[model samples]
Target: MYSGQSIAITGAGGGIGRAMAEKFLAQGAKVAISDINTELVEKTAAEIGATAFTCDVASEEAITAFIQGAEAANGPVDVFVSNAGVGFPDEPGGHAAGGSNESWELSWQINVMSSVYASRALIPGWKKRGQEGVKGRFVIVASAAGLLAQVYSGSYTTTKHAAVGFAEYMAIMHKADGIKVHCVCPQYVKTNMTKGMTEIKEGPGKHLEASDVADSLFAAIEKDEFLVLPHPVIKDYFQAKAADPDNYIGGMAYRAKTIDKGHIPLQ
Candidate 1:
């Protein structure tokens, strides 16, 4: 579905964003790549012959301008990937329960509201063009944490859940208009965000690469699947949780405690 189409990807400077940008370019798509890091975005854009834009996804004005800039450069965007995010490690004094309002607000802005801002700016154009059914795609990179709470990162978990929910709503509201929405839920990937997590042991096929996730996303887009789970185990986990919520939460808590055994808390 993405062949020779124009696509816009936020957070295209690093990790999953960069991986997706490379994969799309490889698939013969004209890509408009945006990131807060202008230098990296420009470098990647130059490398792949993509149009680059510098814009913080958290800023509504920036997102709007980016949409206009991308359209000016490569016509109306056929696919929009909302993938920018940040992580805050768990802190002492119950970080997951009720801590760090600032962190929560920032997470909400980038992880959750960025999708909203992008959809708002682009959906109107999509409606006017009446191009919903003809290979249009909106892909949001949510997380496995969206399906299940992360032990230490309350804000990340909450916002990821919101991102997935928003994607569902968009799909429901715009399906008749031909817009396709997809949410990607991936487990722990080896990225700068999880660089220091010694406890996260790499099991067989456990740690997915960013490029792996990106490839799954592209496949999902072609299939028009709403949920793109790079880590297929997550779908099983999700079903198990849905079948028995309390038991699932209990099991996760037990596993977390086991993982933290004998470790000194970060000072």
Candidate 2:
């Protein structure tokens, strides 16, 4: 179904973004990828046969430029994946708001505003396409942290929640405008962001590989679904959270009590 479609993905130098790009390319789609690291992104493009651009997704102008360049290279984007994100460690003091203002602001920019900018740039074209009965797809690679919470990363969790909210807003307001929105909420993945973190070896919440995430996304797309849960168990957890907030908080707090701030792998 993706054959000849124009696909654009952010943070594609490696990890989940690269996996998404590879999956789409293998499906015969014309793919364009961007990352903040020019050298790394260029190398990834060369290796994967995708058009490459360097973009700091924290900047709106950069996002607009990336989208325009992607369209120029591969026609208008049929699917645009906002996959770039940032994570910050809360200070070792165990305070909820221990992160610096800069970290929180950066998180807000990259995790929340980047999607807004991309959507702003894509919506007009998407609307135009809608008039022709074609729908544009927008994917947000948010975290299960958005729905629940990431214990030590205050900024990441908050901003990711905002990301999910904005995705919901867009989906609610633009369904008739030929826009399809998908939000990915996974527990943990084997990305650079979690490179030094502990990976659960067995049972539920086991850390996933990048390709596993890409596979989940494709499965969601095929099913015309909204939430892409790479870790299916996250659904149960989310339901449990909704069912009993007090119990969920108690359980989370107990589980996190022993986690030292020094151990968190800040991305």
Cα RMSDs, all models: 2.7, 1.4
Best by TM-score: 2
Instruction: Please report, in order, the local distance difference test score of every candidate based on alpha carbons.
Output: 0.83, 0.92
lDDT of 2 at 218: 99
Give per-residue lDDT, candidate 2, residue 230.
95
CA RMSD (A), model 1: 2.7
Model 1 Cα lDDT, one tens digit per residue, 73-145? 8788899999888866466556355757887788999999999999998887787774435546788999988
After superposition, candidate 2 runs with Cα above 4 Å error: 130-134, 260-263
Give per-candidate clash totals: 2, 0
Residues 96-166 of candidate 2 have per-residue lDDT tens digits of 99999999999999999999999999998788773464479999999998999898889988999999999
lDDT of 2: 0.92
Residue 140 error for model 1, in Å? 0.4
